[model samples]
Target chain A: MDCWIAMCVPGGASLAALAEVEHRVLGLGEALGGAPWVVTHQVRAAEGGHYAGSLQTQRGEQAVVQFAELADASGGGWGLVDGTGLVRGGGEETHMAHALASAIAHRDRTEGRVVRFPGQADLPEQLSLEELVERTVVEDVVRVGVAEDASPLLRTNGYVRLELADGRVRLPVIPWDDGEVCPFEQRDQHPCCDGH
Target chain B: MSGRHDHPHGHHHHDHGHDDHGGADYSDLTIPDTELRPADVSRRRFLQAAGVVGAGLAIGGFAGPRPATAAPGGGRGRLEGLVWLNGDHHIHTQYSSDGLYTVRTQVEEARRHGVNWLVITDHGSNAHARIGVDKVNPDIVAARSELRDMLVFQGLEWNIPAAEHGTVFVAPNSNELTVLKEFEQQFDGTVNGWGAGTPANEQHAVDAIRWLGQQMLSGRTPSALFLANHPARRGIDSPHEIRQWQEADPRVAIGMEGAPGHQAASIPTPNGPGSGRGFYTGSPSAASFPGYPLESYRTFGGFDWMTAKVGGLWDSLLAEGRPWFITANSDAHSVWADDRIRPPGQDNSAYFNANGRYGDPVSTGTPRYDRGDFWPGYYSRTWVGAADRSYMGVMDALRAGRVWVGHGDLIDGLVVTVRGSGGSNPPGTLGEKVTVGRGEDVHLQVRITPRRTPNAHGDVPRLARVDLISGPVTGPTGDRDAMSAPATGVTKSFEVRGGGEMVINHVFRAVDRSFYLRLRGTDGNVSAPGSIEPRQDPVGNSDPWQDLWFYANPVFVDVV
Candidate 1:
């Protein structure tokens, strides 16, 4: 079974630091005999915003044991969560992860939001945001366990599950950044009219 | 001069001593009644001689006597007895955080490049507002006295709240420094922490323009102007923000930069910066207005997309019958391939903060191709047609929209006139309005003087084609974010063959609706089907010299 281990580092990490953290997470997953591990940087807009690093491992039972040991060593802020449970949990943890990511990546688009998957190459330098979105394959998503009376913020949350027309699970995934420079959020940003 | 009083400069008292031909009303120097044709005389020479020419006064082989009927009274009529002056208003000096060169060096360079007037618009910042604004005034005053023929105005590149930068300048006066310092401290986005894209911040931008107008109205300054700079480069200047600024105070926020500075940034590698033209290589951000397309982040034919696209934002504004104008300038922080470098040993940011400006640039002797701008008047120029060559005259001309902008010395001069076909009524020139009887035909006559001399790049530019773009006055749109005027497009395109003065004429027959017509010309180096097909400029490596263009302000024809 596939499962995700989420880690929250209260303060935001730099792009370089996040890349190193992904490398460490991948190494730890490999040491526990979990191959095919994917680590993504999740930008969360809670506690004044920070990046929550999450790792998906195919050897879920072993990876959950490793997450427990790591959480005990690091003294907290780590969790072993099922992808389906997170989407159907209808809890604050699910809402926080989904809404913050949506605010950053899907703020402008009115249609299906762009969620990055593993193995996607870094966007070619100077490629515009429009071109990047055009090249990405947008998947149909079905919201599960979302209350109709949810606030506007919750309605825009990315806590969605991919479901086929017959109500079978298509892909259990969460919105993630592949540790690459998002075209929407450039690494090199200057204040308005700062003598570019 | 009924509507002349409506301008902020109408009650202007010229306190500066640089107006050599003081207080002379040249409006009376009309064309003489008799026919006198001088085939070899140039317009400049004729104006200098103050010689009265007859109905068929010929100058530079393209002059034809225009009817001298009494112009319509509201000062919206054709400007008379004018001299065209070339200038740049978006120049920077060491007062800017990212800038080099001193005020004297910039003024001297501007004079050497044939610019008659310039404004030192150092970037607005915390240090700039606190000290740089006041520190730079003495240099400007000295430059004015030393270079009596050149007009140097003190201004700042305002970090407009929730928008792009703007050139906010005032006519030179006793209150110039005080007004500028206070305005920068109170309203500069960087100084006031209003850079975010929020409703309150957007309103602050509008309020800044109104404050400038208030300063002018209260007699603190004779006149003031605010032109949004590099508006489309970052995609932050939304159409609604532009409309709000213009509507805030039409007298102050008169226009925007048609083509941004840093024209040389796209020069190919091993010789130039090899970056996107105007350094316009970024993507949209959260603060950016969503309606703008990806193409808006780039330059088309070395012009801002808003101005380059025929039926785009600029047309959208003009179609509403608003009198917003366009200008081109060298937002010169440093010159491309210049040998000047900041003095050695001092930490730049710390030094600037401590001393209010960088030490004067030192000669490096080795040219730095990585630099991304051209000196003022080296690559871009804004031509203003003024009744007199005084400070107030230039300000009045700009506010009146009697202006046209050119790049790379594309053309030596341009004269556009629109008249009622076979009627004796006075014609409308650039930025003027002519009331015509409904259904009456109108003739547009354009006389272009091609460059007889080589540009700074050591090549004489050739005029290849001229495009006439016109659109209906659809009135203001219900959606302020509207960015397109679908009805506006190229009505005609003229191909050029020789270097002599090219005269082109087009007639609008049986006109029924109120409309406006503007002109744009190119060297035929790079182009696609304009705003109709909505051509996109390629990403990078666009050589600024290879693509030259000139845009003339429009003439509105009011149908009654």
Candidate 2:
């Protein structure tokens, strides 16, 4: 399936740099669509700088998904993306797309930028880059400490980031005020400790 | 809270030259049971001399079109000869971009489910502003003729500025469409003339209410009113904003939803839609009021956090000495457990933008576990004690605060009366302001009747307990952003036997200061003080019939 992506290039980004960022977003979408974790996933660009599409599984479970850029987090290049949408059965597509977006946004950065993704709680049993892309997207991952402002942003997403076994942080996707608590039993067998 | 700015207070002068809707029905304001405070004959003589008694007879003049047929009914709290009309002010039809049914379908469903009055509030959009608003009037007028007993109003779900949505409705007349169409064009946030959630747009929200008031003043319609819907869904409806809306047009800006619709959402399963109760799953955004807590973000028992909290934001407004009332509605877009699905092959946006072609309601044989809402009037009911069953009667009662709200047929009848010894009349019903001598005491009489028939769900609702909440009318706070009422709370709770009607009476000795008392009843399954405790936020419950509640407007006692 197709994914929609909107890019906000940094203030001084060149035309060539902007084109490269757009090309990378398309590549990331294509990688996610080709992944085996999802039964079917597609994204397409829509009006208003939003990507509107669908993601489904072999079990007939699916979601009407939309993805958009929050802001230009990439200082002079492409930035990581944040995703939110209603999921049926599991939010694997939403989780995978968001992780891929983060990995893509942070692919070439050298400042040790720590990217935060939503649904820190909904990560799959085996959290690995291979599940999302053809091969190693990043050879060496920077385990930077969580940013101080990450708490507030995570709070806005109705989650408090968790310090996983490998010092990675993730958010609980659903906000509390929505009145529906996450009903999964993923806490006991968190994906962070499940070896990549 | 400390750094907040205070808004300038509006002039409190309200002229009382108009005739009260029920000219001679004050005697019907009876107390089934009584408790009295001792005062000399001079006390009765003094109240008569001071014009404190029977003053409600001349309260803000109601000059509106009278009902062609006035049904007769006798109830303790109703205006002498008037009756109670249960209604829903917030409703949506196919005209609303997200709604699924037509005008006729909504009216028929609501009437069958026991609602006597309903307002057709399609969402305000540029398309609506251009053509849809004018187009829906003939259907509404036709519906009114078809169901002459039911009052069908024309309204729009206004995209209120700097905050949430509100219901802007008027007493239906030939000019109703003209007024709503123009009003939306001028003040709606989605309309091209104004932007969303800005200070200027906030002021325009106030301007819009006053403009509706102007419509009433110009005799375009007998009455016009605006009510904020699902206020706490986004924490943007700040205490100051609410205070400002009321101060901007006290007569026109009435109250908000005590219980929001979508009662059947958040079904506890893997594939459920999980929109949360009332679709209120939003967290604090850039536009949110920072003062709200994490607990304020969610719905408790299908109600906004403000109203569910015994001494919460709603009480904070009432503590300011204004009659800011509360209501419940369906916000009905698609009914819960619905069987239809969006016709296959169309993209979400395409189906949404293309209104009628979305799909027809062909049952798929299996219940749509993901759909999250109830049809209007099927579960939530806003009961207005009106002088008559006409449009003006309903609007005037709402403006007067003579209303009670219920969910899942929790209680079909509720009468709350506050009586002063010196008043020659029986007592003052919900929303009336009564006066008594400084040393004289006041008594409260509360009665509730269980629904005789089962609800649309076919389950009989059992009354659990009634909570009587009272607080001093401590005027407006010094800090405009104050969001709590430490002084207001559940002073007493009366337990009921499951089989029948129940009544409770209590007397306050020498109530020397101004204060107001209101009532709330629940099924007792979910009960807490002020706000729902953090751990008790029920997230995945799908059955609305299991957790039921009813709320009554306040009855004020003014001591001189």
User: Which is the leading candidate under TM-score?
Assistant: 1
CA deviation > 4 Å runs, candidate 1: A1-196, B1-80, B422-425, B529-536
TM-score evaluated only on chain B, model 1: 0.86
Q: Can you give the TM-score per candidate against the true fold?
A: 0.74, 0.68
- Candidate whose DockQ is highest: 1
Docking class of 2: incorrect
Tell me the whole-model lDDT of each prediction, alpha carbons only. Answer: 0.68, 0.59
lDDT of 1 by residue, A1-196 (tens): 5655544443332334344445556566667664433434444332222344344555656655665455345432455555455321112454334423322222122211122343234434333223433553323222111122322121111222111223221221211111111222222223334442
B1-560 per-residue lDDT for model 1 (tens digits): 11111213343332322222223212122332122212112222222222223323322222322221111112234545788999999998888888899999999999999999999999999899888998999999999999999999999999898878999999887789999998999999889977666678889998888888667544456577899999997788899999999888777788999999888877867788766678776544445676787567767778899999889999999998888899999999889999988897542789999888999899979999987799889999999998677777777778768899999999989988888764656788887777787888999999999998999999899999999999998788999999999999899999999999999999999999988999999888866433222223433356788889999998888887
Give the per-residue lDDT digits (tens) of candidate 2, residues B217-277. Answer: 4445546789999888767687888888887767678899988877777555544554567
Candidate 2 Cα outliers beyond 4 Å, as residue runs: A1-196, B1-79, B193-195, B270-272, B341-366, B424-426, B528-536
Worst lDDT window (10 residues) for model 1 chain B? B33-42
